[model samples]
Each structure stands twice: as structure tokens, then as C-alpha cells.
Target chain A: MASHFDVAAYALGTLDARGTEAFEGHLASCANCQVELFELQELPGLLDTVAETWPDAPVRGAVIYGLPTKRRRFQHLGAATAAAVLVFLSGAVTAIGFLGWDGADPPAASEPPTALTRLDPVAEEPGGVRGSLESSTSHAWVETTPEGSRIALDLGGITGSTPCSAVVVSRAGETTEIALFDPPKKGERVVVSGTTPYPVAQIDRVEVRRVSSGKIITTLKAPEK
Target chain B: MTERAEWTESRQSAMLPRVGRHTRAVRPVAVVPDDPKDEWVRQLYRQFANQLSAHVLGLTKYDRQWTEDVVQETFIRAWKHADKLDQRPEMLRGWLFVVARRIVIDTHRGRQVRPIEIRGTDIAEDRVGVSDKADSTVDAIVVHDALRRISADQREAIIETYLKGHTVDEAAVLLGIPPGTVKSRTYHAMRALRRALRARG
Candidate 1:
């Protein structure tokens, strides 16, 4: 019992003979060490199998040993590294672009849209309301800008890359095709926007539907005036 | 032991058998470098090359070309970070494993995003999906990721005692520290690993 810190050492089976003897003497009466030892019992086995979880464990007798030491290998490797870096950069850029879209920033690539929140006071009209069709989730808001009414939509749970259109319908049964875009991959947020000449007061609903089938995927309603 | 002697010993031990099998494929030319950084990187590479290759080969579905690329990339990164990296053998191994593992993961994700026809038409249907198929696979990634989250010393401790299967006294010699220090580092590393696994889950 000179050292009670041999719990991990003993569990790891790394304790020297004398140290093991002392720890076992202490362990006979030590309930705390017993519990600690039991908890760690699985650790070594798990560690041994950690490398086995990958795709080709035991390697299948592949002759893939040693680093590529040739000068020619390094040449192509240089090109591969550049391409890999480009792919990584593009992925990062796409992520950042999506984050920007999630904000009030519009999705147009040519000219940046004026910030919707900074636009002239959103006319005292119907406020935004949440709506969904089936399992899909969607939200839409109409902001009155000097140019026209800007509708922002956040649609999620869309499956596949379907070409879709956002149509704004007024209470008077008139419809305006405001935006056309592809829905994002499944389980990802799709933030999009479209501008309409109609004001916020006149618009009654916004529906996102497949461009080909014209079937509604989701709709966001404007609160009644 | 001198770094050069250690490098030679480690390299020969790991490369001897493989070299005999594939004599033409590998030249096994040992280059003695003048620069300290080059020497350090060579040492790290020699010591951990086999371990990284095996782990990364498994990761890349034993794609020899891809495994070599990842291993190369990992060492390049280690070379770039050599100034900041702890020169200890165990710490270097941990750093290499984490970096190499991430390269494998990133390459997989990149391929998934834009399927590259590297392995011909039959792209191994199962690998095309998410990396979370099996609980053990997820655990492997989680554990490797957690290795980087802990301090270098603690990471080295776990590598010595658990991963490398070294006894406490043996680990002490390899780490150039006392046995008590090794014990404490292993204990702390275990706790940090537990917390990291929980956080990841």
C-alpha cells in the first residue's frame, strides 16, 4: 500500500511484480479500485479492435507498403495536392455562401440584393406565418421594399434536387411566379427569395411547387390583414 | 538514443520484410539530411510510417495510391507544423494519426460530394453512403478525433500505454519520463477521452 495510484497501472497489466503485489494487497479491501478496474476492463480490448473498424482491416495481403520515394510520384502528387486543396476550398466557399443565404442576404449571384431589413419600413401589412405541406417544413416572410415586395423563404426536408418555383398568390386569385430554383439535397435548409411587384398587403400566400409537375411541396401563408 | 540511430532502427525494422517482398516497388534509400527540420520529419516518418500506412490503408479501402497520398499529405502537414509540434515520439505519432485520419475522412466526403471515378465504375456501393454505418466505425472516428482534443503529453501517454502495448516502466523509458508521470498522464488522458467521446456522441 505505498501507492494507491496503481489502479490504472494494474488494470493495464503494466505494474511491476513488487508493485502488483502491493496493489493486490490494497485491492483485496479496496472497493473503489475494484469498480475502477472493472470500468477499464473493456478499454484495452476496445483499443485493440479500434483499428479493425476501418474498411480493409487485416489488409487482404496488399503490397502497399513504403512511401512513394520516386521523383515521378512526387510530380503527380504535387498536382493531386493542388486539386485536393481546390476541392477543399470550393467546399468551404459553398458552405460560407449557404450561410450568407441563410441570412437576410438574397441568393442572386450577379448583383447583391439590398438588405431586406434595411429596406423602407415593411408596410403595416400581413406578417409572416409558418406553413408546411406534409413532412416538409417551410417559412415565408414578405418585406415591402421600395422596388416591390420581397418574399424570403426557408424550406427544409426536401428530397432530391427538384427544380421548383415560388408562386405568390393574391386574395383576388392572381398569381405571380417570383422565383425559380433547385431544392437543396435532403435534410438541408434551402433559403431562397424572390421579388414581386405586388405589395405585402395584396399577397395572400406563397407556394413552392415542382416546376415540372406543378405539385405543391410547401406553402407559407400571410397572416390575415 | 540519437535521433538518426533511432530513425535507422525504426525504418529498418518496419521496412525490412516489405522491402524483401516488393524489391522493385520500393528503393528504400535512406537520405541523411543536413537540416534539423528535415531530420526531424524523417525521424517522425520512419517511426510512424508503417502504423499510419496500415491505418490509412484500411481507411482508403486498401487503395494503395490513395493511402500513399494521404500518408504523404500527413507528413507534409507534420513538416509544416514541425516548429510547433512536440518532438516526442508518442506525441508525433498521435499527431500523424489524427492528421492522416482526417485526410482520409475529408477525401471520402469530397468524393461523396462529387463522385470521382477513381476505383473504376463499381464504386463499392456501401462506401458511397454515410461514414456512420457501423457503431464500431463511428467509435473509431470518435476516438481518433478525441486524440487531438487532448493535450500532447496526455495523448502520448495513451499511445504508449494503451495503443503501443508498452508496460508502465517501458513507456517511461520511451517517453523519457518517470513511471509515475506516465501513470498520471494515462489517467488524465482516459478522463479526457471519456469526456470527448460523450461530447461527440
Candidate 2:
């Protein structure tokens, strides 16, 4: 005989298979247990609420299987030829502006993408070199528009989740603040898009600096026009 | 190559049952991280990550990496919009769930990675209940407070069995008690919790 206490166990999904079978048999005749089950139906969802705040590791990497692997395309090319091909590809990528964008004219700032230039860590600062800076990575690029330039930045490895601004500097030493954003976590990548009124060719460099301390974190130098 | 393509298509069709069929192109947005909010990401992780992961795990059909990716992206978006968020636990939970749902749908449509087709009535389900989701946090807080008011033994019984998803027998072993005692404690605990929640209401 399944006791009345079986209601809670059944409701909570904690019953063993035999226990569950017995309980269901008992529940068939027990109108009280039937009513109680309906009343306690919200228990599991409520329980999930409490479980949400439990401090456990959330992200786990998946083991993938059975997916088709890519076939190597350039296996026949020698190392020197491969190197030359890579150089040509990069140069072609730059000339084409952004991969997958083809048109008779360069795209408007409101349209698609452009080549992203690497933003190297600023090697020197006033007080000393940023010793812990080598671990971070960043990239920036700009597109020219009738109004000015549209700057897009990809950033990673920023510590302290600090508020920072992307500043566009001109060859004439004038500076324009293009974007203001904050890094969400240490060593996680973030993308920011902002606009500046300066033309792309006239731009000299872009700098990402901390808003609070005004410390320069990284810089991207534009190609010479 | 042809066999692989056919296999991928079959797998995609199998996976699409719960995703709901609504095909629309969603452009990926630039995500800016947080600024000046001290330990906000850490706090978000502690309070929401476990639940978010579980919720997303179901949506992704237990694909752990995709679950992690969705959760990570949701948190980053949350951090980016920290200043704009309500910051209340219930509201934040709702926001995170909604954002995570959108990410899953976007991923299903092959926006961020290779496309996989998922079809179902799920999007409507996800959309309709989002705002109502905040009430869940409220209910959780109420139930959690009620759990504290119950006897320690009763609370542990519920935790081991209900919260941890253990069978009564398994929880008995973990709690170092007989299964009968575990059931008895859970019975009493549920009664006490119902009373406590009623009192609160």
C-alpha cells in the first residue's frame, strides 16, 4: 500500500520505478492524493527557481562526433608557394575591403564590413610599461562615409570591466572620440561600433583608453594614404 | 561529401522539433561589455548562470557547448546593458531568459554558425510567457524563504530529492537516512512550505 506521504515524493519526481507504480495504483483510487497532486504541481518550477542561484559551473564544453571534417585544399603546394599565396590572399583581402562584399563602389558606412587592422598593446606609458598587457587582444577598423567615419572595434582580455572610449586621431593631431563602451569580463571578447565625423584616409590612429584613469590600453595605426 | 550533406540535413530536421518554425534573418549586433559596475559579471554569474545554463541546455537539446555559448553571450549582453537593467532579481531573470531564447533561435537559423533547421511551437511558448517569467523569481524567493522556516531535516530532504533531482532512494543514501524517513520528511516539508507560502500570500 502506498502511504499518503507518497504524494510529495511523486510530485517531486523522486519516486523509484516500483514506488511510482505502486503510488499510481494507490492514486487511482485515492481522490485526496489526486487533489493534492494538482495543488502541488507548481513545486518543481518553484524548486528550479531556488536551484538557479546555486553556485555551480554553468558552461561545459561539448564533445562533438560524427561531423564531417574539412578536406585540405593546398596539400600539393610547397611551403614557399603557400607563403606567397598567403601574402597574396591578405593583400587581396585588403584591396577588396571586406570579404563577401562586392560592388562597383565602396560600401557606405551604414552597409557591410571592411578589413580589420590589429590593435597592438601600447608598449610604453608615462609611469612604466603595462606589464600585464600582453595577454589581451584587440582589433579596429573604419569605413568612410559622407558624414565621417564609422569605427568598429573587437576587444578581448580587458581586466576590471572598465569603461573605455575608442578615440580616432587625425594626422593633424586632432582627436575625435568615436565610441564609449565597457568590457564585461576579464579575457572575454566584445565588439563595439561607433561613428566619427573624420574621413577615413585622414585618420592617423585609433586608441582604446580607460575612461576613469585615462590610461592607453591599445592602439591601431592606419595604413599610410 | 554528398553523404555528409545528407546526414547533416537529416540531423537538422531531427533537431528542429522544439525550436518552432519561424524563419527570419537576425543581424548580429555589436556587443559592448560593461564599465564601472564592480563585480557585476561575477554577481550575474553566481545568481543566474546555473539556471540559465539548465534552461538553455533543454533548448539546445543538451548540447553543452551551445548551452555555454548561449549563456556566455546572454551574460555579456546583460553586462553591456547593465546601466539600463532593472537590477531586481526577478526582472533580471526574465531578461536573461528572454535574451537566451532569442540567441538560441538565432543560432537555430544558422546566423552565428552553420545552419541547422529546427521547427516547433516553442517560439510562441517562449514569447508569450517572458514577462510572466519575472513572477517565477518572486515565487522562488517566497519558496526559498519558506524552506528556511521549515525544519532542517525536512529542508535537507527536499533539497536532496527535489532540488538535486535525486530519487528518494538515491537521496536517502546521500542524506544517510532510510528512504522512508526521506519521504516522511519531504511530506512534512511540503506541507510546511504550502503553509508558509499561503501565509505570505
Candidate 3:
């Protein structure tokens, strides 16, 4: 004594095996259920059409778990040969490069280059910075150092813009634009050491515009970073 | 060292027979010399590869290469499970869709530390007919539109059971409902979907 709902559900492959069996038992005696099943069969076809928008291809290397038994031995041999060749090449390159080097003295270890230190935001007065600029497109941020001598612009926020590109241009006509395929979300900060083109370190004057649209989303100036 | 060697030897011996059986199963039988199964798999790939790749790209916002990798992985799983699949070739498309979705989920989950949000873009606009293409004889768009009309919970229940291959128990756990409720909701949702698809057709 299944309902019409059960029959339709079974036909649509949404019902479990037990439900499907129950519906089929009802369907065996009821012409209405049979007709409904026929009708419901069309649903999968239609659903397929809606799913068509998202086309996907079958994955590869799924057929074979690993190398075929026959090929395994040959593969091992080939790998050993490759390793030997690589070792020989490395030795030859090292011999050629360091052939004339004196063994008497070891080179002194040079100190690593100093990393740029980030300034503490708490040290600066809260209202000392008058204007603020932010990018509307993504999570782009510009932080002014407490000393007002440098500004760090982290361009990590530009997520889904086509023809994705960004540039950091100073007032002195110095422009450095880098084309990013997948820009990091953690914003990269650029320091504005001094003001040349603009009187103050005004981010409002330093426009961050999309190359394609030419829309300036963020515009503001630091107190004097 | 001796115990370890013995354990390794036993494991290898156990696996050898299973591997042999697998290889033998792929060999052509006397009745079907050409092995229609292999052809069937190839045809499945040719028919669905591009569409599946598009769907994956839509969901992940990944490059075409990554989408291809997903597709490749899905097919590899299919081949490994070919014996189970042979009896259900008619259900192959549904199984592949489920497998592909699982792979996407697993890939995302594996990189849990960096959760990448797939941004919706117009890149997949042209391939919008994929759902329909899964079964072209029927009006898939109508069914889709009708699905939208249903309650979101109902729709999700139906999708989880069928498209996503969740068992009633699993769906119940996921939806935080009783298994009986899941069964009932799935039954009702399927009925609605079938009716809508039929009406459109």
C-alpha cells in the first residue's frame, strides 16, 4: 500500500532498495503506478539536462593501480640507470666548477641579510592618522608605520578579478607592477619611504585601479608614512 | 627484523592472489573476445570527461589542469571498482558523478588549513547544459527549475541521497534527522522531482 510519492521516488533512484521494492510490489498490481514509473523515468533525463551546465571529464590513471607486473622489473632497471646518470653528471659538474678552488682555506660564512621589521601600530596615536583608504574589490590593506616614514600596502585581497594585475607606484614616477596568476591572500605591504609627486603620503592620490575597468576602488592618504 | 620480514612475506603472499584475480578478471572471456567492458569504460570517459571537468572547475575555481587531475582520479577509482561497476553500467553516470564529487570534497578537505573559496565566475556559463546532457531525451531544465521551487531542505535531502550517494543513515547523520525522516523526505522529494521533470517533458 505505497503512496504515489513512494513510486515516483523509487523510479527517481532516490529511494533505498527496500523502498524501491515496496513501490515495485505496489506497482505490479496498479496500472497507475506503472504509468507513474514511466513518467518518472523521464525525470533523470531532465535532471541530466540541468546538470549539463557543469561538465566534468573522467579522471586518468584510475584504471591501473600501479605498474603492470611485466613492466615493474624494467621500471626498476630504468630508475637505477637514471639515478646513476644523475650522480655522474652531478660529480662532473662539481669537479668542473670547483676544480681550481684551494682546499687550504674554507670560505667564511657571510651573515644573512636583515629582514624588514614591522612597526607596532599601538605606538602611534589613534586619531593621528586622519584619512584611511581601502580596496573594495578584495582584502587589500595599507598600514602606515607609527613614525609616518613608511607605508606598507598588502595586496593579498585581490581574489577574482580577470586580467589580474597590480602595481605600486610612488610619486617620483617609480612604478613596479607585477602580474599575479594567483595572488597570496596575505596582503603584501609596500613601504612608501618619502613623498615626491604628492605633497603628503595621501593614499587617495595613490589610486589602486583595475587595469581592465580603470575603476579606482581604494583611495586614502596616511598622516605621513 | 625476523618478525618484520615474516610479516612482510605474509602480506605479499596474501596480496598476490588477489592481484592475480584482478588481472585475470580483465582478460577477455571466450564469449566476449573484445571485452565490451573496456569499450564501455572508454565510451563513458569520452562521453562524460569534458562535462565532468567543467563541473569540477565550477565547484573549485581551479585551473583546467587541476580539473583534469580530478577527472583522471575519478576514472582511476572507477576502474579499480570496475567489477562492482560492471553489473551497474546503467547507473555508471550517477556513480561517476558521486565519485567525482567525493574526490573534490576529499581534495578540499586534505588542504584544510588553507580553505580556498571557489569564486563564482562566468567561465562556466557555456557549459550550463551539462545537467541536461546527462540525460538529453528528457527536459532537465524544467526539472531543475522545479527543484528550485521546492524547499531548500527537501532539495538537499534528495540531492544527498541520489546525486551525492548518501545512505539514509548517512543523510540522517548529516541532516541531523532520524533515518525514518530521511527516508520519508527523500521519498517525497524524489516524487516532486520526478513529477516536475515529467511535466516538463
Candidate 4:
């Protein structure tokens, strides 16, 4: 079925696959949308100028597949807690010094031990972890935490319920199973979290291995520090 | 002589371009210890880093560090799939934009799940919202601004369903609103933005 035409959606470059294909189909014959997409193109460029007001910072050699270096971890907080936490954090996190953002030197305000509330943690592991979802069949993120090593695997690599083992491999070549998960529903992008007893820093890589044949489906390696 | 002409023709063949440029045995020039692929990625990063930073900075609402990360990740993807990519600069730029955009949307959606992101979103919406208005005359750009001015509920509806690129059912699930509400907000958003823009004119 053809998706409904939403010009604003198209203009913002924010359309899901179905909507995009449908819009392009409509655009093939609709001169109007063509004209508008061209005009709207300038909007992103204009918005680009907003970065000028932002302080200059250097982005060096970046490892894209590395685990996200910065984010507010409100996930799995439950809706109510997430909301409450969001309310608390936004007001509390008034002026965290971002690297290259500024050097105001307000250490007391920025790093009060009380503010260490799991709101945002620096990616402190010498070699940070990164995730990839570019593959249509899989989604994953490898992360380090104070307690242990964690890997969030969105099992989309295959259809049907399959038993899979989440294992962490150390640089010294030790393998340990972290968790056994119940089979996720077929063809759904379900994220199942697994943790190793090993601290994330010590782990060399995390892999999702099929239990039946012991085939390694995918792996997330810790980047060199 | 006829034999001389044939000899000359054969001699010219030797000067013609060779198919196996690397087939000759020469002293191995010192190869860089690094993979040539790494060099390709570095070149791409140096060429488009500033532009990608600017574009993604707007999308990420000027979270400069996050924008830089997304930009870096985009290049990394380009590097990993270097064989699959067209070598043309425009194609690489488009590919980077597409990948970076998905990261932005994912980041945006992930942020929406948290209350903190919801708070700053209004501020972001208004800043970029007006910035878009100040810059262009596209009717859709006007609507982009007008969506921000509408009731937050209605705007959220449109944003989830439309701007943030969610389908009706998906947006419904994400927003905890009904699919019908998603459709209605989209309708109301379109009408309001059109009306608002017309009123301005």
C-alpha cells in the first residue's frame, strides 16, 4: 500500500523506508514535491550555519564502530523513572564541560560526587566499545560499566527462535558465557542485554555465538586505546 | 621494405600502454606500514569533516561532541565498506549524509525515551525552527517552523509521525498515542503550518 504523502516529513529528511519510497514514487510525477524538496534542501544548509555560533573544536581520527562515547543513559529506566530522571538531570546538568567546548574551570560545580547519578558517564575504558546496526539482520552495542561488561544485542540477524550464547573473550584467550536468554519472538528486533563478570576494560571482545552449532554470528571488538 | 613496415608496427606495440602496470619486478618501494584503506578514510575525513560537522550539528541540535562522533562513525562505515562505495566525491558525501542521518534519528529517538531530552527538545525545536524560517522561503520550511508553534501535543504527534520519520503505527507505539491520533496530528500540523504561513504573508 502506498504511504500517505507528508511534505514536512520529506522536507526534514526524516522518512522511514516505506514513506520514502512512496514519496519518491509520488515525486516521479509530482512536480510540486520536486520543487519543494529542492527548496527545502537549502534549509539544512542554513541550519548548518548555526554551528558557526558554537565554539570551535577539533574532531580527530574517530573510530566509528567504537561504542558511543557520550549519551544520557536513561534506557531501561522504566517510563516513570526515565521521566523523573530526565526532569532531575536536565535541571541538574546545567553546565557540564564538554571537551574543546570551553575551559571555564568550574570543577566544583561540574564534578560534585553527588552528581554521579548514572546520568552520563565518561567513556573511561582505555579502548572504548562501539556498535553497528548497518546490517539489516543485526543490531548491537558493546559497553563498559562500573560493575561489569555489557553487550546489548538486537537479534535481528535471523528469523525464528534460536538459542544463542553471549560470550566475552579476553585478550588472554579466555572465554566465558554471561547469560542464557529465552528465545525472542521470530523476526522482531528485540534487544537482549548480557553482562560478563569481567570488567569491560579487561574484555577483548564480545560475540554472539549460536548454541546449536557453535557458530559465531557477530562480534564487537574493543578498539585500541 | 614491407618487412621494415611490419617490424616498425611490432616495435610501436612495445610502447603502447601496458595492461599489467604492477607486473614488472622492481625494488619494493617502502610501503606505508598502514593499510591504504586507512589512508582513504583519513582523506575522506579531512575533506568533509567540517561540512559533516555543520550538517549533523544542526540535526543533533548542536551537541558538538555527538555530532563529531556521528561524523566519525559515518566515515568509519565508509571505510569498512570502501569496496562497495563509489569512489566519486558526491556519492561518498551522500552516503555519509545518509548514514549520519540515521545516527541522528536513532540518537533523537533514543533521547526521546528520556525525559531530559524532551526538555531540551523544545529549546532545540525553537532555535532550529526559527533558524529555518529566517533562512528560507520554502513553504515546507515555513511548516517546519509552524509545527513548533502549535500545541506541543499536536506537534509531537506530527514530529513522531512525520518529522522524526516514524510511521503511524510506529509513532503510535513510541508516543503511547493511538494510530488515529498520529494521523490526526499530521493532518492538523499540515493545516496549521499552512494557515500560519499564509497568515504571515
Candidate 5:
């Protein structure tokens, strides 16, 4: 028999349900196992300390993360990729207008936003759509379905110094406004994933512009399919 | 062979955030890396750093210097891929836990060999460099240092059976000993650790 090492096994999370239940029976009586297991319980916490050091260090997080001190946004990505990303950013941001999260026209959504902690952080980019951006510092990809196209925009460096909004403007001057935010602090990346009701052909440009001054921070023209 | 983790309601609530009363229009979801200058991460570190440090330390088998370096590297990677991490508290904690574990695995894989040396009572403060004021951080360093005091065989037994989350038979197979030996070694290791911890205090 493996003997009364059940406490240790259970502490290590290696016990099956029956074994665990069996150990729980012993654990209820064994003070020695309880105390020893308590010390062993700290094992995982100590392991975490090893990696938690970098954040507590004197150097900046960006420098330690191996990102250059100079803010080279989208420096790792190519120009074509950047434009395509901007196209998606604008498209997705505009989709907020249709989807109903637009900051400007926040449709009757007076209710509190679902707790930020409740959101799934994973970026979901389904395959099968085409899009483009120009003169951009962001990256993007597109997902298309019979319903329409949704653009997944990576807002890595657009933490401008003023309130910002992504506006999708059609050739005929029609516009859908989405994603309004105060200037994000430097080095913060804001990401938006939204779908557009209009096909890629009908959209002329997706511009990330300052809401306060109406100046264009960056703009990407739609690439034709 | 396993610790079953049933998905209770609490653990399963990490679905994406939704808004409004009904589904009138498809919502355009956005995740802005909040507190980009390490504020949010700092808080997260404060919360989970102890548990994560302890687990990673085990993976490295009591290499304090190696553990500290790997933990820092993991968080840096977390920031670089910030958008992927913007989620609920429990999910964020789980995400960091997984990332820290992977870092430990990667760090171990890159090493030529495990040293298994006990530096006596000297905390690897030099390798950790900057002294963290957090009591949990200090305690982790101290406890890890003590693990080194026990014989390597006993320490390895404890790690395989306890920290690595292995069964006794599983640990015995890895350590090339009988299951009985794994237990005795673990029993002695725990006693030694308790003594060392009390002595350090």
C-alpha cells in the first residue's frame, strides 16, 4: 500500500476522487498531515515569487519585457499589414454603432456595463474576410460571413493625448461613429473587434480621429476585394 | 492519477462581457489594455505573485535565482500580449498561473542540468537582485532556501509527489525507488522543511 501519503498526494493535486475522499477521512483525524500539508501548501506560492520579481524590479516593465524604450508602435509589422489592421479597426469600431456600444450613440444602454472582470480577454478573429488600412501604426485581420464583415483591430499604440473615436466614412459622406475613449496612457494598446453592416466595397475609409479637435490621428483606405 | 476540477458556476463565468437588455445589434467588443504602465499588472502581481512564485520555484526544483528570472520574464510576456489577457479576475489569475507554469517549463528545458545544490541558509537574494518588501516574497525565498537544506533525494521526492502534483507510484517511477521510499522520503523532507522554516524564523 502507498500508506498515509494521501495527504501529500492530495496536496499535490494528484489524487482521484475516491482517493481524495478517502484522504479527507484521514485528514479529519491526522494533525500531523494537516500541519505538514499546510507547509506544503506554500509551495505553489513560492514558485510564483520567482516570476513575480520582474514586475517588482527597478527597471520599467516595457524594458524588461524586451520592448524598446523608444515607443516604436507597429515597428514589428509591415506597412501593408498596418493598413489592413487600421481598416479592420475602423470597421470594427463602426460596428459598435450597429452593435450598439457606440460611445457617441450609446443606444439606451444606460445599464451598467457588464463587469470588466467578467469579459473574456481572448481576441477572437474568425477566418475568411478581406480588409485593408493605409498610413497606419496598428495591425488588423478580417472575418467575413454571409451576414457581413467584422474587423479585428489591434489598438497597440493609438493611446493619443485626446479623446479619440474611430469613424467609418462612406464615399458618399455617410458615417458610423464608434469606440470613443479619453486618451489612453502612453504604451497602452486598445483593441476593438466589430463587424460592419456595409460590405467592404461600400466603405471608403476608417479614420481614427480626435473627438475634441476633429483632427485625424491616422486613416486607412479600404482595399478593394 | 488526477485532481478533478469540476467546472462550478464560479469558474465558468469567464465568458465575454455583454451589454443592454436584448440583442438588437451585434456588439463590437473591445479590450483596451487597462493601466498599461503596469498598474493593473502590479496589482495582479501582488495578488498571485506568492502562489505563482512558489509553484514555479518547485518546477525549477528550488533554484531561487532561476525561479525569479523566469517569473519576471513571464509577466513581461504577459504585458506584450496584453489584449489577450484583458478578462475577469479569476480568468486573469488562471491565465497568469498557466503562463508562469509554462515559463518554469521553458526555463527548465533550456538548462543543461539541474544543480540540486543546497546553498545552506543563504537566500539567493543576490540573484533576485532588488529586495522586494512584500512579506510573501521574502517568505517564499526563505522557504525555497530551506528546501535546499534537505538531501537532494528527499527534496526531489517531495517535489515529484507534492509540488509537481504526482502520485506516489508516479514519483517512485521517476525517482527509481519504491512507492514506500517515496513516502518515507517525503515524510522526512516535510519534517526537515518544518524544522528549517522554524529555524529561519
Candidate 6:
């Protein structure tokens, strides 16, 4: 039989599982072992009662399983690597996001208030007056005037081997053929600027086409004012 | 071997008598108060939950909600296995430590297999509330006073190492001392604090 201290240690969980089981077997008939186990178990309760001020904050799932499932067996390695990458990426993204346009410092609050006018051309172009004929892979600008409006199409970002063209139509059935640039590249802007022969309020639609494949990628329209 | 097996069967049958005419005529066994058992379970809960929570929080970088969940699960498991808990209150503490450790391992493993959403905002608020409540507790104030009554070096070591959660090396560096010295001082300070708190009680 082991000494009282050994049994106590086993009961306390300081011993490995085999040692604990052996000790427990001995403890079944030994009154001394039972007494010691009782004593050691109280230590946790005392510490908890004293440390009552800290509320339990449960760990979140994202923090636990951020790594891919395949690497779970090597959790130590996986967690360490994932944590390092997450921390690095978070810091980098935060730093970049904070550096607003023209290198302005980020706002004091962590989250910035939503911008009122989100008129960045790349974002608004897809839902612009032009429908599917609008170039998905291109940048566009729409400038409205009291009399008419002009749109500059830049289809540099589109991926295709074919060439494209554009056609503009007014609400009054007046049609105009705006020549499309072939395979638009960076630094090339297709300007379709002209006074609408119809009144500004009557002009309705604009369309861009892929001439080689005969596909309409962009379309724009003016809602009845 | 057959005799041993028959003995085991008979023991089981004796412990669990048949529920029939003869059993109904026999008196039930006496019910005894298990004060030690109840106290031991209570003590285990009291001793381990907060420290486990603190350790988990520190390990996980103050993930407030996860710490709470782990603590809650640890205690619930302890309660469920109350029969297995040691009778000595001191041993109960260590038993709970082991349980808490297992709970942590299980939690970590489960997290690997599942998707977890971290609610950053609520955790921050919960931590603030916990700290505020701890500060308001009378025992905390008493402990703080006892801590102040100790030697300045001992008090400083305790404050920086345990209360402030600084690593021994970090506290040593801050105090311009060696890590070993810092550790020894903190240990002695803890002993002193324990004595003081016990005396007050």
C-alpha cells in the first residue's frame, strides 16, 4: 500500500490515471485514504469562494475552432499557427482599414458611422440605370445634367476574348450608336457624352454590348421623375 | 471461479432484495445524514470555480463567456459525481482541479469539431461587472487590508504577481529582482495572506 500522501495526491489528480486507479482500489478499503481525499477536495471550494468577484466568461466557438478541421489532431500546432495568423491578419486589416482615404487617421470609436453618400462608382455601377448590358467587369461614371447626362464606361476588368460595343436609346425611341472600345484596358475610358436630343425628363435607357459575342453586359435607365 | 461468481450474485441479490410479500414485510434500511458528503461537494464548488475561471480567462486572453461556460460545466460535473467526491474538504479542492482540467480539455476538443461564435461585446461587459463586484465584496476588502498590513515587499509581490496576474518574470523585471526571488516572495506572501484571512474568520 502507498503512503497517505500518495493516495492524497492521487485523489487530488496530481497522479496519472493508472496511479489514480491503483490508489482508488487501495482507497476502497482504507479509511485513511478516504479522509485525505476529503481534505484535498475542499481546497478548490475555498479558492472559489474567496475569488467570487470574477464572473465566468465562457470562451467562444470561433476562438476555439478557428483552424481547419483537418488539423485538429495536431491541435497545439494548429491552434498556435491559427492564433498567430489571426492576430497578424487582424492587426494588418485594422491598420489598413484605419488608414482612410489620403492616409487620414481612423476615427476615435472602433466602428465608424455609416457613410451617407456611398457613391463610389465601382459599387453603384451594377445597379445603375443600365441593366445586364452594363459591364460587370468595368468601372463607370454617370453625370446627370439639367438637359441630359453622359456616362463614361471603362470595361478593363472584364474577362473575355471577344470585343464589345454599346448602344444608347432614349425614352422617345431616338437611338444612337456609341462605338464600343475593343477589349478595354486600364487607363482607357470610353466617354459617351452628348446632349440628349429628347428632354432630360424623357430620356430613359442606355445599353452596352459585347459586339463579338452579341451580349448585353450593361443597361441604364432614368426613372420617371 | 463459479463459487466467486455465485458469491457476487448473492451479494448483489442481498443488497437489492426482491419486492414481493416477504420484502413488503421487511423494514427498510435506516437513512443517515450525509453532512460530510454535502459539505465536501459545496466546498469543492466554492474552492475551484473562481480560480478555474481566472486561469481559463488568462489562458484564453480574457474570453469572458468561455471562461464562464467552462466554470459552469466544471461545477455541474462535480455535482453530478458528488458520490465519488472525497470526504475530506481539502482533497475535494484537488479533485475539483482535476475535474476542471478535464472539462477544459473536453471544451477545447469540442471547439475543434464545431463552429463557435464569439460575442465580443457581452464578454467585455461581463468582465467589467465581475471586477466591480469583486471589488465591492467585503472579503476582498478584508483581504486587501490584510495585504496592506504585510511587509511592503511581500505586499508588492502579492499585488503584482497574483492580484494583477503578472507572470513571475514580468513582475521580477518590473520590480528589478530575479524571477526566483519574486516567486518565493509571492509564495510567502500568499501564506501570510492565508493566515491573516483565517485569523479574521
TM-score of chain B of each: 0.45, 0.39, 0.38, 0.44, 0.37, 0.39
Candidates 4 and 5 compared: the better one by DockQ is 5
Model 2 CA deviation exceeding 4 Å by range: A55-225, B1-134
Worst 10 contiguous positions by lDDT, candidate 3 chain B: B118-127
Question: Any idea what lDDT model 5 has?
Answer: 0.48
Descending-TM-score candidate ranking:
2, 1, 4, 5, 3, 6
What DockQ does each listed candidate score? 0.06, 0.12, 0.10, 0.02, 0.06, 0.02
CAPRI band of model 3?
Answer: incorrect
Q: Which regions in candidate 1 have their CA more than 4 angstroms from the true location?
A: A1-4, A51-225, B1-135
Model 2 lDDT tens row, A27-94: 54455766676566565556654554432110000000001110122334577754553343233112
lDDT of residue B167 for candidate 3: 59
Task: Judging by lDDT against the true structure, name the best candidate.
Answer: 2
Compute the lDDT of residue A155 as modeled in candidate 2: 53
- lDDT tens per residue, model 3, B1-201: 453343233332222234665555543346434434445546667777777777778655665676776787666555445554533433565555544654554455354443242211211232222232332211333355456657877877767665665656577788899766766676677677666543321
Q: Which lDDT value does model 6 have at A181?
A: 53
Q: For model 4, which pairs clash?
A: A64-B73, A66-A129, A66-A130, A67-A129, A67-A130, A137-A156, A137-A157
Task: List candidate 6 stretches off by more than 4 Å.
Answer: A1-225, B1-136
Model 4 interface CAPRI class: incorrect
What candidate 5 gets wrong by more than 4 Å, as runs, is A1-4, A16-18, A47-225, B1-135, B162-165
How does each model score on lDDT? 0.52, 0.54, 0.42, 0.47, 0.48, 0.42
User: What is the clash count for each candidate, in the order shown?
Assistant: 0, 4, 43, 7, 28, 58
Maximum-DockQ candidate: 2
Q: Residue-wise lDDT of candidate 4 within A69-116, one digit each (tens)?
A: 211232234777546544433332211211110111112232222222
**How many residue-pair clashes does candidate 2 contain?**
4
